[model samples]
Target: MRSSSVLAIVVVLLVCLFKHGNSVPVEMETTTAMTTEFTATESSRKDIVFNSTEGEMEKPRYPHDGYCGHLEEACSDERRCCPDFECYHSEGRCIYLMQ
Candidate 1:
């Protein structure tokens, strides 16, 4: 009877361990998926563009102040910066100018 009890205890412990082990991998997968989604959102923010005619352009509130003087000017891939003059050219690094 004692041996049977010991065997049952061992089986229960084994089942609990197995379940815990499987749960860890599931949690890790969930975390990785969230990280990937956040990265994609951050990259898309950098590539945002606005129509010149919309007149909805606004200067970047952080990092560099004022409009970006040139395409080579310091710009954040996460924030929008207005063009110094007008947005006459095609799609580039320039943002729409504020009216």
Candidate 2:
């Protein structure tokens, strides 16, 4: 009878250990969450420039060309484009200024 009781105790202890061994899944979940958050932060940063939206910092588009390397000069035309805004080369594409 005593041996049977000891066997029962050992079995209970083994069951507890098996249950605790599942902690690996919990740790993996935590690691995955942290990795996901880090990736999201990096993506968001990449899409931002000067703390402004990506659209605001977009490269200048030229009326004759696509992406203009002379965006600085293109931005100078106040009558055509908005002030303090950037320009990009849009080869042969006309710039539509909001009247």
Candidate 3:
């Protein structure tokens, strides 16, 4: 009877250890996945400027006429404008104003 009780205790301890060990790896995997996703998102935010000698154009005048309204509008029209009116190339977006 004593031996049976000891065996049961050992089994329970092993089960607890296995559960805890499995959880640690799962948590680590989740954290790594989140970090990878964040890095991919950050890289995508960077603008890809195309420079070709034949079709390349000079930088437009700063302080575009108006707000870009949307990122696509600014990129498609090649207008350097930002929502905050800051005229500068930032992250992959254009800031329209000087300040």
Candidate 4:
């Protein structure tokens, strides 16, 4: 019985080899880099605000404590700190709480 099972396994292996041994390797198509002209207008560039003191005071990117509070930044009861952060009133700064 064991010899017959071994013969059946050998037959299956031979069948698989015969089916896949004649398979051809497929050639992949080569990609070519295409160049395109990109023109950016002055108005479009003006929309982005950089690290300017005037711009930060006038228009803050994250209002109402939307962003994470830094160590030096001021935080109070009225102005809550970011997630997993607490307002250290003694130092008047926001601090990250460890889990």
Off by more than 4 A, model 1: 26-99
Q: Comparing 2 and 3 by lDDT, which wins? A: 3
Q: Report residue 20 deviation for candidate 3 (angstroms).
A: 0.2
Regions of model 2 farther than 4 Å from truth: 26-99
Return whichever of 1 and 2 wins on TM-score.
1
Candidate 2 structure quality by residue, lDDT tens digits, 1-99: 999999999999999999899765753433434433444476445433442655356544434434443323443233234323334445422344335
Residue 41 lDDT in candidate 1: 68
Candidate with best TM-score:
4
Using all chains and alpha carbons, the TM-scores for the candidates as numbered come to 0.26, 0.25, 0.26, 0.42
Quantify all predictions' global Cα lDDT against the true fold.
0.53, 0.49, 0.50, 0.66
Alpha carbon lDDT at 40, candidate 2: 48
Please rank every candidate by lDDT, starting with the best.
4, 1, 3, 2
In terms of TM-score, which candidate is stronger, 1 or 4?
4
Per-residue lDDT over 1-99 for candidate 1, one digit per residue giving the tens place of the 0 to 100 score: 999999999999999999999888543433434433445466346534454887775533334543343443434444334435333344434544557
Q: How many clashing pairs in candidate 3?
A: 7
Give the clashing residue pairs of candidate 1, or none: 46-77
| Residue range with the least summed lDDT across 10 consecutive positions in model 2 | 75-84
